[model samples]
Target: MKEQNNTTLMTTTENYEDYKDTTFDYEHYEELCVKHDIRRFAEVFLPVFYSVAFILGVAGNSLVVAIYAYYKKMRTKTDVYLLNLAVADLLLLFTLPFWAVDASIGWKLGNAMCKITAALYTINFSSGMQFLACISLDRFFAVTKASSQQNFKKRCWAICIFVWTTSLMLSITDLYFSEVKEHNGKHACLPIYPKDSVKEVTALIQILEIVFCFVIPFLIMLFCYTAMAKVLLKTPNIKRSRSLKVLLTVVGVFLITQFPYNVTKLWRALDIIYGLITRCETSRTIDLMMQVTGSMALFHCCLNPLLYAYMGTTFKTYITKTVKRFSSWRKQRTESVEEYTMYSESHVEETSSFSI
Candidate 1:
C-alpha cells in the first residue's frame, strides 16, 4: 500500500510538470488543490458578469455625458463634476471589453495594449472615486456657504484639474509595471515590476490607493454629508425626513458598494507585505479574489449615475423624458413589425389562391 501511494505521488508530480506547457488546465489544478484551492466561483463569474456591466455601464454613462454636453451645457459645478464622472465611467467601461475577452479566453492583445488598458482602468477608477468626493464637497458647500458664482466656478475648475492630475500621476506607474505575462501557455495582463522591487512597489501602490482613493475620499464624503444632513435636519421649514433620507441613501450606497472592495484590497496589500499566505495556490486565490472585487468597485461607476438621477430633480426630468421617448420608439417598432407580418401573410394567401 505504501509503495503504491509513493508511485501515485510521483505520477501526479510528473503530470503537473507536463501540464505547464499546455493551456490553463483549471480542472486538473482543482484536483491538485488539496493544500490550497486557487480556483473559485469567480473564474466563471467574471467573464459573463463584466460583459453585462460593460454593456449597461456604457449605455447609461453615454446618455449622461450626452445630457451634460448637449442638453445641459455645464451650467454649474455639479454639472462639471457629473460630466467628468461620466467621462471617467466611460473610460473605465471601455477597458471592460479587453478584460471580458481576457477572462473568457486569455490576453491575446500584446504588451503595449495590455499596459495601456491597465493604466486606463486604474486611472479612471481612481479619478472616479476622487470625482465622487469632489461632488460631495461641492454639495456641502452649496448647502452651507454663501459663495459667489464666480468663486464656485473657479474652485470647481481647480478641483477638476487637481483630481485629473493626481490620478494620472498615480496611474503612470502602471505603464512601467503592467505587462503581458504568459502563464501555462495562456497570457495574463499582470503587473510586472522589476524583480527586486516587485513586491515592494506592488504593496506600496496598493496601500497608497487604499488610503487615498478609498479611505480618505470616503472619510471626506462622510463628513461633508453628515454636516449637510445636520444643518438640513435642524431647519424647521425644510422637509427634514426626505432630505435626511436622501443623504443617508447616498452614504449608504457608497459604504455598501465600496467597503468590501477596499477591505479586499487592503488584505491583499498586507498579504504581499507580510507573506501571510505563503503557498503558491493561496497566492493565486488572492489574485483571483482581487480581480472579482475590483470589478465590483468598477461597477459603482454605473450606479453613480442612478444616484444622481435620484438626487437631482433637473437630471431626473431629462432622464424621464428620454425614457419616455425610447419607450414610444420601441412600441412603434413592435406595432410596425406586427403590421408587416399580417400584410405579408394576406398577400401570400391571395397569390397562392389565384395561381391555383
Candidate 2:
C-alpha cells in the first residue's frame, strides 16, 4: 500500500510536468509566429515613404488647387473634374502625415482619431479614383460626342455630389470599425471587426475597396481612353500623336502604380476568406508586399496634378502667365523701392545745401 501511494504521487508529478511543458511549448510557438519582421520593416520603411509622399503630394495638389482657384479656371467640365480631383488628392494626402507618425511610433492617437483618419483615407481615396473616371468620361465625351458637352456640363455638379456621397457611404465601414488596438506590443490604428464576423467583414471591405476604388475606375479609364485612341487614329489632327502618347502614359502609370497594390489587397481578402496562406513566412511576405505596393499606389496622388492639370495646354498657359506676372510685379516693386530711396537721399542733400 505504501509503495502504491508513492507510485501515484510520482505519476501526478510527471503529469504536471508534462502539462507545464506543453503549455510552454505552445506559448513559444505563438511567440515565434508573431510577425516581428513586419513590424521592423514598417518601422523603418513607412515613415520615410510617407513623409516623401506627403511633401510631394501636398505640393503638387496644392498648386493645382491654387492655380484653379486663383485663375478661376473651371471653364470646362474637365476643369471642374480636375479641380475636384485635386481637392480629393489633397484630402487624401493630408492623412499621410498622420500615418507617418503612426508608423514611426505606433498609434498614440486615440480611437477617435483612428476612425477619422481611416475614414478620411478611404473616402478621399475612393473619391479621387472616381474623379479620375469622371475626368476620363468627360474627356471622352468632349472628344467623341461633342454635342453632349452641354448636357454633361450641366450634370457635372450632380456627378460630383454623387461621387462624394458614394465615397462617404463606402467609408462608413472604416468609421465604424477603425480603432486603436494593441498589436504585437504596440498599438495600431486599424479596423477591428467583431470577432464572430471578422473574416467576413475584412474580406468584404477589401473586395469592395478593390472593386470601387480600382476596378471600376480602371475600367472606365480603359474604355474611354481606348475609344479616344481609336478616334485619334482615324483623325488627321497634328496633335493626334501627342494625345495618344498622353493617353498611353496615363493608362500605363495608373496600371503600374495601382495594379500590384490591388492585387495584394485581393490576395489579402482571399486569405481572410479562405486561409490561403498558412505559413508565418508566407504571411510576412504578403504583409511586406502590401506595404511596398501600398506605397506605390499612394504615389499616384503625387502624379495626379502633373498628369491631369499641369500637362494641359490651358493650364500651362495659366502657369506661364502667373509666373510672368509675378516676376513683373517683383521687378516693379524693386524699382519703386530704389526710386523712393534715391528721392529721399536727393531731398536730404538739397536741404543740407540750403542750410549751408
Candidate 3:
C-alpha cells in the first residue's frame, strides 16, 4: 500500500511539471509575480527611475572627481578614499541603464547585453562595498594611532589602485552564474549553475556574498564608527559644530542604508541551506525580494555624493567660494566690456563732429 501511494505521488508530480511546461496557464502569473510593480505600473517609470539615478549618480560622482582634481584645497588624505568611492558609484550607476532597459522592455536586449549588465552591476556592487570597508579601516587606523599614525596620505593612491583592481578581478563570478534565457517569450537573466553543481554553487556563492560583502563590512564600519563617536564625545569642552554634526550624519547614513540589506542577505543565505535540504521552491521568492531590496540598495550610490557634500568641509567651502568668485568675475567682465564700448562710441562721435 505504501509503495502504491509513493507511485501515485510521483505520477502527480510529473503531470504537474508537464502542465507547467505545455500549458501557458501559470507562466503569466509567475511572470507577473516576478516583474517589479514599479516597472509594470507605467512603461516609462523604469526608464525615468534609471535616468534619474544615472543623472544624479554621474553628476554627483563627477563633482566629487572634479573637486578632488581641480580644487587643490579639497585634496586631503580622506579625499583619496572618497575619490575611489565616487569612481565606484559612478560605474555602478552607469550600469542602471542596462537594467532599466531590461526591466522596461522585458529583457529584449539579448544575451550579450544581459551578461555585460550583470557583470558591471556585480563588479560595482562588490567593489563599492569593499571600498567602503577600506574607508572604515582607514578611519579606524587614523583615529586609533592619532599621534603615531603613519602618513596614510602618501600610501592612499596605492590603496585606491588595489581596491579597483581587486574589484574587477572578483567580479567575473557574475558571468559564471548568470545567463540570458528565453522565458515566457521574454529574455531573463537567470542564475544558471553547472547542472550537477547547482545546489553547491548556489549555497557557496550566497554564503560568500553575505560574509565578504555584508557581515564583515558591517562589523568593520560599526567598530570604526563607534570608536570614532566615543572619541569625539570624550573630547573635553570641544563644541561640536554643524560640520561635526554632518560628519556624524554621514556615519548614520551608512549604518541605516546598509544594515537592513545585510540582515536580509544573511537570512537569505540561511534560507538557501534550508532549501537545499528540503527541496522547496523558496529560492524564487527570495530572488524576487532580493531584486526589490537590491534596487533600494542601489540608492546608496546617490546618497554617498550628498554625504560628501555635507561632510567634506574643504569641498563644501571651496566649491561655494569658487562658484561665487566665478559669478562675480563674470559680472565684472561684462561691466568692463560695456564701459569700453561706450568710450569707443563717444570718441568716434567726437571725431565726426571735428570733421564736420
Candidate 4:
C-alpha cells in the first residue's frame, strides 16, 4: 500500500510539471485565427476618397466663405449660420489629409499633431452638425414667425459662440487622451483612455458624439423642415414647390450620409462596453463598414454648399452675380491690356519715324 501511494504521488507531480511547461501561447493562437487585412483595404480606399472629398470640399467651402466675405451676405440669421457652417466644414475638411495619410501609411505626425488633428476634427464635426440645426431653426422661424426675426438676428452671434464653445469642450477628450500607439507593427494616432475606465469613457464619449452631433441635429432638422414644408404647402407661393424640394433634399441628404455612420459608431461604442463582437470576421466587417460609412459622412461637407445654394435664393442670386461680375472684370482687363499694347506700339513707331 505504501509503495502504491508513493508511485501515485510521483505520477501526480510529473503531470503538474508537464502542465506548467505547456504554457498558453496567446500570440500563436492569434496567428492561427484568420487575420483581417483591414490595413490593405484602408490603404487603397481612404486616400483616394479623402483626396476627392478634401479637394471638392475645400473648393466649395472656400467659395462659400469668399462669397460671404466679399459680398457681405450675412443678411439673415440663416446666412450667419450658413457662413459658420461653411467655416466649420472647411476646418473639418482640413483634417482629412492627415487622416488619409494615417490610414495609408500610419500616423507619422507625432503625438502633438495627432492630438491637435483629432481635437480639430471633433470640434469642427460637432460644430458643423450644430450649425445645420441652427440653420434649420432659423429658416423655420423665418417662415413661421417673421416677428421673431429681430430676436434671432440679435442672438445669431451668441448662438454661434455657444456652438463653437460647446464643440471645443466636447473635443477635450481627444485633446487629453489622444496618443500615438503601435498596432500590428504600424503606428496609429487614437485616443487611449486609462485602462481602468477605457470602456466606460469610450462608450460615454461615443454616445455623447452621436447624440450631439447626429441625433439632436437630425431631430431639429426633421422638426424644422417638416414644419417649414407644411407652411410652404399652405402659403401657395410660386416658389413653394421649389422650397419644399430643397427641404426634402436637405433632410434626405442628411439622413443618407449621417444615419449609417452614426449607427455604426453606436454599434462600436456598444461593442466596447459589452464585448459584443466575438468573432474575428464580424469585427473585421464592422471595421470595414465603419471606414466606408465614415467616408460617406465626410462627403457631406462637399454637398453642403450645393445644398445651401439650392435652399437659399440669396445664395443663388449672389453666386450668379458674382460669376457675371468676375467675367466682366476679366473682359475689361483684357480689353484694357490690348488697348495699352496698341498705344505703346503706335508711340514706338512715331518715335522711330521722327528719328529717321
- TM-scores vs. true structure, each candidate: 0.79, 0.84, 0.72, 0.83
- Supply the global lDDT for candidate 3: 0.59
Give candidate 3 misplaced runs (Cα > 4 Å): 1-48, 73-76, 147-154, 241-248, 276-288, 325-356
- The per-model lDDT (C-alpha) reads 0.69, 0.76, 0.59, 0.75
User: Per the 3 Å backbone cut-off, how many clashing residue pairs does candidate 1 have?
Assistant: 0
Q: Write the per-residue lDDT of candidate 3 for residues 1-356, one digit (tens) a residue.
A: 10011111111111112224332344443443443432243236546766787888898788778777777443445567777788888887887776666554556666676566667776677677777787777766676665342565667777877767766665566666666755434555655566565545655766676666667777777788678667666666445455347547766776666666655566655543442312223434444344445545677788887875545566788678778887999888777666665678576664454311
lDDT of 4 by residue, 16-48 (tens): 111222244324434444433665766778788
155-187 per-residue lDDT for model 1 (tens digits): 888889999988888877777767776543456
Q: Judging by TM-score against the true structure, name the best candidate.
A: 2
The true-versus-predicted C-alpha distance at residue 315 of model 1, in Å, is 1.3
| 2 against 3, candidate with superior TM-score | 2
| Candidate 1: C-alpha lDDT | 0.69
lDDT of 2 by residue, 80-122 (tens): 8888999998998888777877776767879899888888888
lDDT of 3 at 303: 84
How well does candidate 3 score on lDDT at residue 235?
67
